[model samples]
Target chain A: MSDLKNLRGKAACVGAATTGCGEAPGRNSTELMAEAVIHALADANIPLHEVDGVFAATAVHSMAAMSLAEYLGVHPKYSSGSNIGGSSFLAHALDAAMALEAGLIDVAVIAYGSNQRTAGGFKSISEPMPFEAQYEPRNPITAYALATSRYMHDFGATRDQIAEVAVAARAWAGLNPEAFTRDPLTVEEVLAARMISDPLGKLDCCLVTDGAAAVVMTRAERAKDGPQKPVYLLGAAMAHDHRMISEMPDLTATSAADGGPRAFAMAGYGPNDMDTVQLYDAFTINTILFLEDLGFCAKGEGKDFVGGGRIAPGGALPVNTNGGGLSCVHPGMYGLFVMIEAIRQARGTCGDRQVDGAKLCLAHGNGGVLSSQVTTIWGTEETL
Target chain B: MSGYFDGPGPEAEFRQFLADGKFMIQRSKGSGIHVFHPRVMVPCSGETDLEWVEASGEGTVYAATCTRRRPEKGGDYNVSLIDLAEGPRMMARVVGIEPDQVMVGMKVRARIDDLNGAPAILFEPA
Candidate 1:
């Protein structure tokens, strides 16, 4: 398994693309997937015929791997769908890296697209396994609220502190032209927003939008020859601690405890080494938890860590520069968007939201009500 | 391996006990540890023959949350993680308090409530 860590620098994410975001009423999931793939291939300047490997988050439409393979008409070797929720795509990226290392396939495409808002909004994960169906926590919102409540009770964090996350998210979103809701949101506005769950207000949750995003990963050598300056994959790791929220070892922690160290250690850096970070923001609670567990700060100091202008643009650490799922497009699972933003940042292509001369960036994904975590460290080729 | 094994097994027996207004958790015959969500085997020791023990129905709230997504069924509902005295934990709702009022480490006792046409376990402040 340690030898697999040597797969480090062998592959790089060469292209990233997002399309059909916001309220696109006409396009369905399939069309959005195809459009994103076309744009991503165009970004890479690689023909559709060169692709062999594919991984997709098929939560929007079930067996989207085979369906996407058939749609694109480029079937070669490998295909997989391990939908562990939003982090599914990063798991796909991690698995695709392993597959590419094993000499199984080349040019992997991890894609996701959904019409959540146009379709009247997302349907929470309802599928249960065995005893889960018989005995279950009926709502995902309630589950997340329980986590926030526990975080507050345990760490003495306050609602306003958590609301600071939303305020920062909108600040970044203000710079993004394509973000769904870019209106400046004050901490007061976030606190004043209607409460959906006990602690999480409407703003604390992500935007429901129609969107598609895809990433193309190929050999680092080939990436050098590609059109876009390749963003080398420095390190990547994925892990899930619990399937059920009740079964999580600790309420305030997540798989980031295990995944963060593995990803950063392989890349030979620490949280302090990251130029900017893009931790998943399915809820504001997630940002705080990820910041703490990923070693940005000590366990319970996340509220203070993000209290000042720390995570906002032009701050010491700019996060979710594309505004993230909070103000950007959260078309169901958002792992793919995380990749797109990381790659663009590494390439220094983000015009306005770009972190000035960001040499290295960390893109993390959280899935299934914080069930799984996948972290990928992407850096400019200069670092490689 | 240990105490009484009723003919119905864990899952069926768990549902049956809910109808009887009783709460039970699986105790490993080998390790004598309690496991929750009704299963046939012990997690750590792989002890197959588990015994059912009636819980004191008394526990403490590990965490609690209020959700308001589904308005048609009901606007909001509170779900909580309750840590039982029997050295196990379970997920259910606590009654007799507003969802916002429930706090971590609050002592609660188990009670049965009708949900979706069947008796389901719930916790109330002790």
Candidate 2:
């Protein structure tokens, strides 16, 4: 088997794009996805016939790769429809990188779309676990609330500290014109929002929006011919610990703890080397937990590490520069959008929210109830 | 046909046991390792040498959250993960107190309760 560490910088993202988000009244998931795929291909200055690998995962379709391929009118030589929940897109990036490294396919297109917001709110994409379903926890929100309770209990982290994550995400969103909820948000407002579940109010949850995104990738050598500067995939790792939240070994920690080091090691860099970070913040507590698990701080120290605008725009670390799923467009699975934001930041294309001279950045995706984690390191041409 | 393979699956057997007013759990006959959700095989070893046994019904709250509901919609209820004394953790609710009052590390005891006209296991203060 090929070593994952050896796959570093084997593939680079040449093009990325997102369709109109928040509300596409009449557009179906596949329609939105095809639009994104077309736009991303155009951005790469590549035609549809150049894409030989199709990778996708969605809440709407079981055979997402096949569906996306059929919709785009291409017969791909390689395809993957593995769905590990919200992190499915990041997993696709890792899979695509491996395929590109092995010369299995020349060009790969990873795409995703969701109409959950207009389809009448988010539905549980994962099948209900026999044991966990009986308790009637409100799908993912309750699962996350349980984690919040345990995290707060173990570390004495207050609700105010947890609310800071949402506040920071909103602050970032205010700078992104494409963000869904860009109005200024406060910690107190988050605390006082209607309780979805104890310890997590409404503001702690991510926005329910309709959107689609696609990214085109190729071997690092071929990526140079693309229209936009290629963002190289320095390192990538994906992992999962459990399906049901109750079965998760540690509620306060996620699979990121396991994958983060492996990814960083593969890239020959650590958390400190990142100019910015993009995390799939489905809930406020997600930011706190992932920051800690990704080695930004000690296990219980995430609560304090994010306080006083540490992760906000003007803070030491610029996180969720595209506003994140918390305040940005979260159309069910948010993994792809995070990667797109990181890619934009690495390209130094983000206007108001861009991190100064961003070169090396980390984008992490979380799926299920912190079940699946894919940590990817993206860097600019200068880093190579 | 031989009767060696004739029975309800692990899930059905578990629900039937609950209906019989008995709280039960599964264990690996070889290693005595416990598992929850009544799976067919051992999670660690993937061995099929599993057997059921009566549980002590004693557990401790590992984590909890109170799900909010409107007043006419039965108000609120506490959903919790209880670490059973038998070494497996399971998801259930702790009752006999206010929903928000349920705290992590609190002792609890499992009991058979009716939910949606179906028998289920729930927990209460020990």
Candidate 3:
């Protein structure tokens, strides 16, 4: 294995933005994505001419990289179109960093945009080609609901405990100006929401919206000139389990069980070192499961760990500080937002919602129906 | 207009592949049980070898969840992960009991249930 430390470069996150989820009256996926890319360049204080590579991530929407590059009017040195579910953006960021380190591309831009609300509201494409025909045709909601049920059965976790996750997330969302679902949600409201899949109510599932987010990566040397306090990418890891839910070793554990430790080891840091965490919360149960899998708490102790206001704003280890996929805008690419929030918090760019002296952040992303997972550790110091 | 469950033909032949004992669950290669649909060839390397074994219907419920809303093709059913005594976990619908009675690590046994007149393996509390 090549030492990631040896591949060191001044990797700086130049631009980051997420289109707030809601009805986009007249925008398609490509149009939304183009606008996001332009905004990201402006945010980074970089010119389009400086960008030499483009990495695009999306689940449902399809726009070729070359076509998008043509639309954006910037011919790049290298380009890639990655489709690895929601985690693709974060994985793309790491890929950009590695490519920059390898001298394949100097400046790489990663972007994700989708009109899932309109696409799903009106009849859009069927499940992507890869998952279209499975023995048990896995739908995200149904697959996650099955896992939620298992968690409840194994841990004696009650409906109230699961609702607590939603409640805490919404509380954080209330503080975030960019969050979409800011209405204060209660345990009662969560339990009472319309059921989509048994045990998984409307509150348990993430929202679908037309939105876009982008991130720019440049070598560490170049980054210092852009953002005064650029957050460095210390380490990254990705893992994939059996694609179908049935083939999974256990629904309670995700591929993260394999990915998380490797990422921490590569960065030479432990979970305790992280001052803040941004876990992928497509469903509230996922957050609880991650709490256990990431070693924050022992297995079956997640219910208890989250019950006593621990994961909330003033708790021991504050999580989802910018709200999560549950209460925040879920643009199908929620992981990108996780990375965005982590960067904002680490840089202390977030005004009131920022954690005090947060030096380390853990950003996790989930792809497919818990099929693929990736974890990235970022900090102020170049630990590697 | 294509419906959700619109299949090319009846799934009876696939079910028979399991009942007649012709179906073998190997740890590796072109074998193993069919847990997910649209069977694809699973390659087995030397590290993970193929082993022929019979499935002991008896197992414990690793996890289970109830569904009130389902695609129009499939009605409301309980989806669960059953840990077979033979050492593999499978996903199937749980039947023959009320929702509240379902518990994790609860004893369960495999039984064939009809899905739209097609027989599919299901689990029930023993």
The candidate scoring highest on DockQ is 2
Kindly list the per-residue Cα lDDT of model 2 for residues B7-122, writing each as its tens digit: 88888888889889999899888999988978888996898878899999999999999999989988899899999999899999898999999999999998899876788889
Error of 3 at A375 (Å): 1.0
Cα deviation of A312, candidate 1, in Å: 0.4
On a 0 to 1 DockQ scale, where is model 3?
0.35
Give one digit per residue, the lDDT tens place, for model 3 in A228-252. 4777887788888776666777788
Question: How well is each residue in A1-384 modelled by candidate 2, as lDDT tens digits?
Answer: 756569788899999999968888878899999999999999999999888999999898989999999988898989999999989888899899989888889999999988888888886556778787777888789999999999999999999999999999999999999999999999989989999999899999999999999999999999988789899999989889898988999899898999999999888889999999999999999999999999999999999998999999999999898999999899999999999999999998999998999999999999988899999999988876
- lDDT by residue (tens digit), candidate 1, A1-384: 365358677788887899988888978888898889989999999899988998887575677788888889988599887788888887888888888877899889988888777978886544774443433454456568778888999999999998888888888989988888889888888888888878788888888888998888887778899889888888888888777887777889998989889998778778898887988888889999999989988899998888787899878888888888898878888888887888888888888898888889899999886889999888887877
Q: What alpha-carbon RMSD in Å does predicted model 1 have with respect to the real structure?
A: 2.4
- For candidate 1 chain A, the 10 contiguous residues with the lowest summed lDDT are A129-138
lDDT of each: 0.83, 0.91, 0.74
Candidate 3 accuracy as lDDT: 0.74
Task: Give me candidate 1's TM-score against the actual structure.
Answer: 0.95
- How many collisions between residues are there in candidate 1? 0
Better of 1 and 2 by lDDT: 2
- Stretches off by above 4 angstroms in model 1 are A129-138, B1-9, B69-75
Docking class of 1: medium
Q: Clashing pairs in model 2?
A: none
